[model samples]
Target: MTPTSIRPFPRWDDARAATLDEPGLLLYRSNLLGSDLRITNYGGGNTSAKIRQTDPLSGETVEVLWVKGSGGDVGSMKLDGFSTLYMDKLRDLKKLYRGLAHEDEMVGYLPHCTFNLNSRAASIDTPLHSSLPYAHVDHMHPDAVIAIAAMAHSEAITRQVFEGTVGWLPWLRPGYELGQRLAEYDAAHPGLRGIVLAGHGLFSWGDTAKSCYENTVDLIERAQGWLAQQREAKKVAVFGGPAVQALPEPERDATLARLLPVLRGLSNEGAPKLLHLNTSAEVMEFVNSADLAPLAALGTSCPDHFLRTKIRPLIVPEAVYTLAGAELRAALGGLLAAYRADYAAYYERCKRANSPALRDPNPVVILLPRIGMVTIAKDKATARIAGEFYVNAINVMREANAVDRYVGLPEQEAFDIEYWLLEEAKLQRMPKPKPLVGKVALITGGAGGIGQAIARRFLSEGACVVLADIDAEALQGVEAELAKAHGKDHVRGAVCNVTDEASVIAAFDRAALEFGGVDILVSNAGIASAAPIDETSLALWNKNQSILATGYFLVGREAFKVMKAQGSGGSIVMIASKNGMVASAQASAYCAAKAAEIQLSRSFALEGAPLGIRSNVVNPDAVIRGSKIWTGQWSAERAAANKVDEGDLEAFYRERSMLKRSVFPEDIAEATYFFAAEHLSAKSTGNILNVDAGNLAAFTR
Candidate 1:
């Protein structure tokens, strides 16, 4: 494919570029290059510009190398995300370098070279950028380029593809030594546009930011074009053709729904992990291919890929797919045990004296033939990004295998990079995990005000939520709003009528597919009705019971099913009403239904205790503001019953409470969050907390 066909055209706007200083131009160039995954995966590359700036301490002009800071993604970074180091200081560090063994000490000297006292830590790639003899430099992991770089004869392929315009360097882990080697090569061979780092990525440089960006894109496109040509000429099947055809869409989804929870449960021996499933055509092709096992065993070629996806994915054997129910689960448990044991052996084989204690041994990526790929991590974003990295790896493997034998980084070399002291320090520096991190919640009536509030609250604490609502329009709007605030990966929406058993089950399945499984169930879907017994029709009575009582039962039953399968225990928080414990006038049906919800909670608590599942209730009364139930006839009916105008209902409820406070959705959300949080309520199940602003009559006695 040509650049126009396979790669994105340069998005540089001259007008935009003209309005920025050198540092701004560098940022603009980095964003442009990082925006396209075809150019590089998220946080997989680094960019830099050597700019002249006033030295803050000396009040004199000096050249500073501004490079993407540690753990920052160039695609979504700001000016502050770049670390500024004095060029002279960086160059002077060459005197202290004591070869590869002491290369790590070089990182300690970096802060001493800070140009502007910038707090953003410089990445290991700083040397790679600072050593290059160019005003601007970009190092990227484009699949098309990595394909050529990961080949057995990568140097020969690089020479053939670029016709000597681009140079090639053999596999050397990124650090001071590699940077020195790069400088040596560039000095030895002047005028070369770029160098493909074998079994890694590509590095390109130019006199200006625009030139550097174009050079990088152009080189990647050229490699893409060559690979496309080679693939067309070969006319061979990918991964030696599909070993097994993919199941139909419905069957595939069912298979994933069945497998994900079990995998998630098995993988959560340490910190619980969220799961992300990828059923894209590319993923399907690779997983179903005959070469899947052998190629996967070779592991990933790029360090960025392996860091996120782990060295290699666990390939589920064909026999496991033939079993069903308990037999299938037992089979999977055995496989996971073996995988963990193997990972332990790998650590034993490669660990050094000072290496960080063995990390999580469970596989991050799992490939199942006919079912696509599932990635597990501490959060939805990490899991999804891990899957994306694996996809990039798959692309590299596919293209390389089509032309020449693909080569993964040697195990010892991969181990050194994985267990590097600097990398371990970075991990140790990460912020503490949130309270609800790795927990998945399925919320019923999630489009409503209280539900949305609960969703937001849960999200803020780092839980993935699946919102289920019968109102499709409201559901979509709430989903978009929450996803915008807390990332698309952390929230999903399913239109579910809670009263319908199938809808309830589908909602749980959706949770399993979107995340791993349900760790918390918030049974908040409800309605309210007001009428004297004689005036209350059977239909009206049944409607209240159906939504309030049956809905809670259905959703709770499904949550219990998933939780039992996981064997990890879970929390169930029912949003009952104060009326459940207190009789109310002219609202017998509503009151009775709510009372049923309270009773069901106790029963669930009793039944779930042995399984490590806890059931609790949050009883919220007169929650008028931002409530969907109040927007209907229920508000006017209650106003009439209280002898107050519709607008005065809130004030009436407030004054009626002993605390003179009207409850809001957020208040109810707080109560629900308390019940759902294991750290707070793990030992307090079979209890009810009322959020009624001091309603004595409704108090649980």
Candidate 2:
């Protein structure tokens, strides 16, 4: 193996290091390493520095181990993310360590070693860092090093690659025992800089923070270079070369648009899961490879990888490429059943007396030969991260198989990690799911005030949203604003002319691709016009019907298709107007269109009831503020009809109401939210909620 051209270079600056204290330097090093995915995955590594600090209680200086805390991502973490423990107390923990069987108990003892009352919980990798002899330490799950570490001849390969600069240790579940073994190995090999933990990760150290960061990078670079050389020298085809060609981008996306909803539907049996699709060059190559099934069957080598992606992914059959509609769904259903059964059997085979109960049996990842990989999880970020972890696993396998046969962690070992009591406890401590968590909503007039308000409300409750509006510029701005306020993963924008069937379908497809499928549909796209029945032209009537009535129908119809395919109950909220149920003067076209919307919603409710789909209407009158309709000529038109100044229209509407109160987008949003939230109004369908400041004529009675 020879060095490759592309390698991670040290980014340490003496000036930067000089300004930062020892702890800050440690953070700097961790951030630098974590900034590159090629170095370490998100929350998949730990770093520490034994810094001299003045004890908060005692005035004396002491050594404190500042390490990446449990469940924190180094790249985005602040100073508070590090757990500080007394070095002397950590060393003293060896006395409490009875054996490997009781190693998990050591975690409880970590708080006792906490210095200065720092409450950040120490990670399981704490022992590995504290046990190292060096002042600075890093434990990283870099794909390159893990490639060597996961090889059948890992130890020999480590020796050959590093020429004794790096050492090797056989696979051990990370705990007190592994830490002790590391310390022993360091003592035996006086000059080694790091040790590659077989089937796990790499542990590197240095006398200084900079050196430790550099050493970690150097080792990973060396492994990457060696693998690159080996691949070149051996000239072995990756994943036994491509067995099938990838579909063209358009066709592939179309296939994904069709398949994702069905997959999401199947996965929603228990808790709903969001799906993420990856079609990067690497993913495309791997999924199209001849050895995809066999390599994927071997599972992931690193515990961090499988913990998110599961032990293995479900590979779609070749017939999937040829099937459509019911045939496609049936084939996928059968595949899912087999995958779940196999997972259940594996759980049974691996369960210990005290093991955690079986988890969701559905695979987190699904691979299609000519398309790409789809990862499903509770939310978008987790699903995306799961896909990334699998991609890293692919890289490891590609390189490892080039040099030597790759091996996954043993099945029993993988199960032990997956069902570990500590991991289970950590999960149990996570915050409860929000009311709308894992639900996806598509808003037809998402750029409008009502749509934006509803989106913000839904996002606050943890639902992913696809904002579809005919106004592309407004849609983009709203998408950006919402994404910034919520998160980029939770909001997406689609420029959709809801009146066009293809555009409406495309918007729903966007929703399916962005989230998994639509659980809630808000048909809010509308237009306002004021014309006497004698003066109303056919064009005005058609325009009003096209946007308000016809548009709602198209969007609602698409939503039903997706929801039905998902086999999950859905909620449809139509943003009709108070005029829908009342005769408004000189607004024949607008009132008629809104009336059509109300009737259409009731029809939908009747048809969808048996399928557990709910349809309801929110009637808001005189929403002059933040309304797109009011921003145009409709305001003057309404004011003229009411015989009031344009500026006094709001006051006029307020005075005209029975309650003399005004309506706003937020009020309408609240009403819509009630209908969409199943826990709030699961049994109340086909109902009309009036947010009209107490209008007598618009009353349902």
Candidate 3:
């Protein structure tokens, strides 16, 4: 088999390319590299071009590598695809890497002195790209060459195959070690065109872009020929008889359905496409062979790939796929039970005497009954990549074992790389701050002071807020105020009674329809009762509990259901009064209702945390002006009956707090914003924050 010819970019003249800015040139060059070299099919690699520009005042030239930007596919990168960095600043990272344990903070803390601040993340391996002395560097997993790397005598064979064209590496996990080793090898063997990593992929470089691209093609073509020859010469036996059995269409789909989620879970992404599978008798026979067990512990081709291709495959015997869903379920039950037990044994073996246990025991890849290998990636791209890599590794491991014992990275080293600082850095970059941004929030009783305040806060912080209230006029009035303060689109108004379940649910449904979904929930609606226990009527007791307690329950239940269904974590802020914590005279129903809301919030918090949702109770003290309880919207006679006067209310509320000041909704709003921000709250779950202007005295007033 002949390899694809490496194409030269006759059209891309560097003088013309350099006419663009550093970023523009970088994107163009990266795209050109991907296009010229067949290695990076479907955006499989990253490229960087380092340039030194003189500082006018100092008369000193500084080196900066314009790396590919995140989220920009190398295949279609543009001028914006690149981010410039001070090479001197980045090269300094080598020193920090040796002494510092947390590399991200050390690296991330370096501000963009020359580029836009809002630029997407620096390429994950910017240091490697920067550390290299080469003007042009390209990293890719060329499929043909990767196939060769999997061979047992791949290093010696590739040496004979490439004949001084590329350097060889024993596959260590990528990142720090790969970069360090490459640098060291390059120092020993200067001017090497590319590197051939065992059980992994290839890397190529040159003084010029064209040279690097051509060298890469040359190396891959040689490796490809070698692989084709080996495949042709090798005779593989099928364990089963000559005939292959195929699964029926319905059964196949049903089997796929069960496997898809497990695959997706392994891939750490949404469902990925199942490309063509090899289900021949020979393939099935190879899968069921005893050779698989020993190599199963070796993880994915790459650690990051695990989020795509999980560790190990589900090995199935030949007869399994012919069954119905129930039969498949039973088969899966038995298979998974054994798999988990094996995983536990593996986990225990892997664990040092005392360490945290593994979270997921299921294999990322699944070997189906008479179905070839299926990779679970978050998406099709990842799944295919994972599948290809796994298939390549298996082939290589076979060849290596045939020659001698095939050794892989130590389990501890694999674990370290899997949980490496670099991997953690990727996770930390976007920890889902402001997850509720651009989502709708509906707060009932939003016309009154506390409700109005909460509504306004949500609006100010980017949520499209609907302030629902029983009073039509008050709702319209508050809506107008919010519209005047926040833009018209930020606030919506609906007149609904908390006591009416139909009206409340209808309001929420309307908000969901208008705003796509409810991401943040602020359940702040409540009624107050002020009467001694002896004088408190059944009507009064029922009314307070109905709105303050039961209403919150109903709204909360709906919100939880909606959020959990959405699958993206949601946040619920239940505004329980400090009254729930401390007793006050003549307010039995209100106090009891508030206490119940607090407990409900706690339960929701515990349940939701696992699902990435959060429920927090905000104990707001003295957000009293226009409060339904204080404003007598329910009953003015009740306010007078409670002996709460209007004029001195602010002072009276302030006197109760340790700060001697009333807590405002704005303060609560800031706290809300913090929780919603992407970078704050490292592990804030089932937590209650008090927003009462230093009010520890819940009973003093």
* Candidates in order: C-alpha RMSD to true structure: 1.2, 1.4, 13.0
lDDT of 2 by residue, 66-163 (tens): 99999999887889999999999999999999998899999999999999999898988899989997899999999999999999999999999999
Give the TM-score comparing model 2 with the true structure, all chains together: 0.98
Better of 2 and 3 by TM-score: 2
Q: Which stretches of candidate 3 lie above 4 Å from their native place?
A: 1-25, 32-44, 54-61, 69-73, 76-81, 93-119, 176-178, 233-245, 248-299, 302-307, 325-327, 344-348, 351-357, 377-410, 431-701
lDDT of 1: 0.92
The candidate 2 region of ten consecutive residues with least summed lDDT is 1-10
- lDDT for each residue of candidate 3 in 451-486, tens digit (9 for 90 to 100): 776666666555667787888998898899888887
Reference-based lDDT, each prediction: 0.92, 0.91, 0.62
The TM-score between candidate 3 and the true structure equals 0.51
Every model's TM-score? 0.98, 0.98, 0.51
lDDT of 3: 0.62
lDDT of 1 by residue, 1-701 (tens): 37356646566799999999999999999999888887888988999999988888889999999999999998899999999999999999999999998999999999999876799999999999999989999999999899999999999999999989989899998999999999999999998999989999999998998889888988888898999889889997899998998888888777777778887888996688999899898999999999998999999989999999889889997677667678878988998899889888988999899988988989999998988899999999999999999999999999999999899999988988999999999999999999999999999999999999999999999999999999999999999999999999889999999989988888998999889899999999989999998999999999999999999999999999899888799999999999999988999999999999999999999999999999999999999889999989999999888889999999999999999998999999999999899888889889999999998888788
Q: Rank the candidates by TM-score, best first.
A: 1, 2, 3
Winner by lDDT between candidate 3 and candidate 1? 1
Q: Rank the candidates by lDDT, best first.
A: 1, 2, 3
Instruction: For model 3, name the residue pairs that clash.
Output: 24-79, 150-396, 152-400, 267-307, 267-308, 269-378, 314-367, 433-678, 434-676
